[model samples]
Target: MQLQAYTFADTTEIKDLVTRTFSDSEGVDEGKLIGNLAFELLTETPEKDVFCFIAKENNAIIGCIIFSRLIFVRDIQVFILAPVAIATEFQRQGIGQKLIRFGLQTLKLNGIELALTYGDPNYYCKVGFQPISEQHIPAPLKLTYPHGWLAQSLTNNPIPKINEKPKCVRALAKPEYW
Candidate 1:
């Protein structure tokens, strides 16, 4: 399988992938949120921090992963990996895993650190993510999970110790809260 950056032509296929992934995990209607976020990443006004990658087999999209730039402390820049999706029939084929590993390697090669994500630690850990608490950094989500909400450093530097409450680091939230 060839992993490459997503193209405009991949829009519908990627949306379908997200819809299926979400439906399998959550429910049907709630699954649409992934597509909505994908739309925001592809078509919305904010363009600086969003990027996506797709896996192709025989020129057909089989999986996708997205990275959105986020802020932790005042000026710190980090990337958030979200909405990783593989076609239902293609699940457990290692396509999604490869997409994440390749995407992270690409981001690290570009000089990024502190990739954050809300996903199962088991899967993300296989790709190098450690629980946020085990590292010096902390999630800005102020949320908890049973092995969800993880972070990984791209470099050898220690992640900043975050004792202060985490504020939402991405997306719109209460102005004073995040």
Candidate 2:
């Protein structure tokens, strides 16, 4: 498999890959829910505020990751990764971590200072993410599973404390998502 940025032409395939992957792992309803979320993230979010990467094998999508820009009171550059999906058959093969590392490296090159994600601490930690508290960097909304909030500094500096809450793109602004 190879990693690359996703293009508009890959829309339907990307959505299907995400939906099927999620459905296989989570449940049918969750698959549809996240599938719709993926579509909105691609179609509704401002072009400058979001980025997507994919893993393809023999020209077919098998994994995908989406990063949306986050706004904070400080002038720091930050992004939040959400709704990652790899083909159910591809799980535990390091594709997700590889995709995430690639995305982080690309973002760092473009001057992004921090990357945040809400997910399993054990899985994320393997990719340099560490559990972070709202006291250090507040999220855009209330986190139902606070322990899942995580972050890692792209730069050499440590994750800094922010006094203000961050703002996420409209597609991810809903309470249910957080």
Clashing pairs in 2: none
Candidate 1 residues lying further than 4 Å off, grouped into runs, are 134-138, 144-147, 162-178
Worst 10 residues of 2 by lDDT: 169-178
lDDT per residue (tens digit) for residues 26-78 in model 2: 89998998888888899999888888999999989999999999998679999
**Local error of candidate 1 at residue 70 (angstroms):** 1.0
For model 2, the local distance difference test gives: 0.92
Worst 10 residues of 1 by lDDT: 169-178
Best by lDDT: 2
Q: Predicted candidate 1: what Cα RMSD to the true structure?
A: 3.6
Candidate 1, residues 1-178, lDDT tens digits: the string is 8999887778788887788777887788767877666655665525567668998888888888988776554556578887788877888878778899999988888778768787788898898887766245555555446357678788787665654434432442323211
In candidate 2 the C-alpha lDDT for residue 118 amounts to: 98
lDDT of 2 at 11: 80
